[model samples]
Target: MSVDNISRADELVPSRYAVPVGDIEVLVISDGVLPITASTLATTTPPAELAGWLDDQFLPRDVVDWPLNVVVVRTEGRTILVDAGLGVEFPDFPRAGQTVARLEAAGIDPGAVTDVVLTHLHMDHIGGLLTEGLKARLRPDLQVHVASREAEFWEKPDFSHTVMPQPIPDVLRRTATQFLNDYRGQMRTFEAECEVAPGVLVSRTGGHTPGHSIVRLESCGERLTFAGDAVFAPGFDNPQWQNGFEHDPEEAARVRVNLLREVAATGEALVATHLPFPSVCHVATAGDVFRCVPAVWDY
Candidate 1:
C-alpha cells in the first residue's frame, strides 16, 4: 500500500454500528475482544458437550475471544452510555479496552455523556470509567446510574458460585471498589426499574450479579434491549447453560431463558455485552431453543 493510504487509515473502519430504535438513536461501539477460557463460558455444561458446541461454532476449544460491546443511547436531550468496556489499566488485556478510542472516533464527546448505566460492577463493565484517560475528559455532573442492589453487592461481593480464574476475583473486587470510590459522588441508584431518559428504561435482572440489570429502549413502535450480561453469545443456543462469570449461575440461566423468550415474543432487537461485535440482532424461537438473527447493517 502507498504511504498516503497507510497514513489515512487511522480509523477508516470506525468499529461502531448505529441502529435506530424508532426515534431513539442507538450506537453499538465495540471495545475490541476479551480473551477468556472457553470452559468458563459453559461452566455448567459437560466438558464434551461444551467442546462439541465450540466445534460447531468453529471456535477455539481453549481460549475464546469474547466480543466486548458497549452502547450509546441518545434520547430526548440526554446522552447515555451503557456498560463501560474493559479499561486500559490492566496490562494483561491489551486487545480489549478500546471503548474510549472508538467512542471518540465515532464523534461522541465524553463530556456530553450525561449518564452511565451500569449493568453490574464487574471489572469488564466498569473498568473504563476508572481509566485516567477517559475519566479526565468526562464532565463533573455525570450521573452513574446503577441498581441499588448492585452497588450494595459490590461492597461485599460474593464470588463463591462463580468459576473465574483465581486472580480474577481479587482483581474484580479491587476494580469495583476503586470505581465506586471514584464515582460515588455521582452515583444515582435505582430500584427495580427506572427510566433514565425518555423511552430508555433500566431494570434490575439480578442473575449475573445481585443487581445485574438490563436496559430497554422503547420509542414509537420500535424497541431494542441492551442486555448487559444477562445474555451472552451462547445464551441463544443454550439458554440453560450457566456461565462461570455469573454470580448465581442457576438464576442467571433462568434470567437468560426468560429474557430470550421475551425478546423473541416481542420481536425487538437485542444487543449484548459479550455477543459478536455490533451485536444487533432479532430473536426467533427455534422450537425450545432460540436463534439470533443478526440485523442488517444500517450504514
Candidate 2:
C-alpha cells in the first residue's frame, strides 16, 4: 500500500522517551546533539582502522552526531534527575543546553526534583545544575550527589597534566566551584557505591574521570542501568578502544569491558548519554566483542 503524505513540524522540539522498570518510570530526555569529529572518538585507534569501521557501519567517517541524554527517574514520591545537560551559557555548542525544557515537556518539574545524581563532573554532564548566570542553583532544594573522588579532583585540578586542552581544566574548575558553592549544604559525595534513593544506586566506575560512575535502578524484579559516558557508540562493539576524553585510557577500557560483560550476562537495559537518541539498549556478547540491540519502543 502507498503511504499517505504527512506534515512535519517546522521548528525543532526536544524529544523524550520513557520506559518502565516495574513500578518506576525512567524518561530519557534529550538536551540536544553535539557534532564531533570521528577522530576525536577513537583517539588511540589508527585512522585507517577507524575509517574502515565507520565505512562498515555505513556511518560517516568525518563527523558523528552525539546525543546528550538526561535521565529522569520517577518513583512513588520522588523525582530523581541524572546527569544535568550543558546549560544555556556553553559558548562552544549553541545547539545544546535544552535539558530543562525537555524535562518540562516530559511532565517533570525541575523544582520537584528531590535529587540530582551526577555520573561524573564533566561540563556537559553538570552544566544544567545552575542558572545561566551561574549565580544560583536551578534545583535549589534538591540534594546533589557526585562521586567523592570526582569532587576531590575538581576541588583542586592540575591542568598541566590532563587529557583535555589547557583552557578546559580552568573552565571546568571555575564551573565546578560555582556549582559546589551555590549548593553547598545540599551537595553530597559517595566513595565506591551507594544508594541515592530507595532503589537508585550509584557505583563508581572511574576512567572517564577519577570519579566517574553509573546509576543502576532496581524496582521490583526489573533493572535499568544509566551507563553515562563510560561506553559510547562504536566503543561498545570494541570495548577496549581508547576514548579521547578518558582520564586514563587503559583504566577506562577495563571498566567498559567489565561492565559490558556484566550487562550482557544479566540482561539489564543500558542507557548511555552519547548513544543514539532514546539511548536505551541491551548488550549481547559477539565473540570477543559486544553488540548493542536497541530496545523496541512499547506502546
**lDDT values of the candidates?**
0.88, 0.80
Candidate with top TM-score is: 1
> TM-score of the candidate numbered 2?
0.90
The total number of steric clashes, by the backbone 3 Å criterion, in model 1 comes to: 0
Q: Estimate each model's TM-score.
A: 0.95, 0.90
Error of model 2, residue 229, in angstroms: 1.1
- The per-prediction CA RMSD against the true structure, in angstroms, equals 3.7, 5.9
Which lDDT tens digits does candidate 1 get at residues 1-299?
A: 11111121266655788899999999999887878999998987999999999999999999999888999999889999998888778778877777777777777878889999999999889988876756778989999999999999999989899999879999999999999899999999988998899899999999999999999999999999999999888888898888888999889989999999999999999999999988889999999999989988766
